[model samples]
Target: KLTAVLTYHVVAGKVMAADVRAGKVKTVQGSELTIATAGGVMVDKSKVTKTDIVADNGVIHVIDTVLMPK
Candidate 1:
């Protein structure tokens, strides 16, 4: 359950802030996450607080809430 929730927050590949688009993206947990780029970038119901945190494996985008896989 915890693992599923964690992986649900991640999308495959290194997606930067500039590359983000308004659509559904497949996560590593085998679930699709809805992304909105209206006023700002939103992941599901969570607003993206931060973006483009470079990591060894991939990039990270901080969200306001934890995403749950349905």
Candidate 2:
């Protein structure tokens, strides 16, 4: 239940902030996440506050709101 929602926020590969563009991306949870950079980086209706947090495995992007799978 919750795991699906959590993985829905995760994109495969080490994607950076600048690398992100407006498009539909396949999330780790096997759902499509709508990414829009028109006004700013947005996943669905959630605003991306921070991005490009480098990690050993993958990067982390901080969003103002938590994402829920539909």
Candidate 3:
């Protein structure tokens, strides 16, 4: 699922993609997501359009595109 793929983009240690200087995040699907700012913080080709959707176990960040592990 896209939600799971985005969730995998998150690190166990609470990291803000905005704070990333330069690095990549590995998704649960084992895909590498490049962190950078075009208009805003982007996960690979997806943009985090919204943030902080709280659930019982974790959070969800809305993205522009569904991320697939390559």
Residue pairs in steric clash, candidate 1?
Answer: none
Best by TM-score: 1
lDDT (Cα, tens digit) per residue for candidate 1, span 1-70: 9999888887778899999999999989998988999999888899999989898999988889877789
Q: Model 1 off-target regions past 4 Å?
A: none
lDDT of 2 by residue, 1-70 (tens): 8889888888888899879989899999998988899988988999999888899999999999988888
Best by lDDT: 1
Q: Worst ten-residue run, lDDT, model 1?
A: 5-14
Clashes of each: 0, 0, 0
Predict model 2's lDDT versus the native.
Answer: 0.89
* Alpha carbon RMSD to native, model 3: 3.4
* C-alpha positional error of residue 45 in candidate 3 after TM-score superposition, expressed in Å: 1.0
lDDT of each: 0.90, 0.89, 0.65
lDDT of 3 by residue, 3-25 (tens): 76555665554444444544576
Instruction: TM-score each candidate.
Output: 0.95, 0.92, 0.64
Better candidate number, 2 or 3, judged by TM-score = 2
Ranked by TM-score, the better of candidates 1 and 2 is 1
Cα lDDT for residue 58, candidate 1? 90
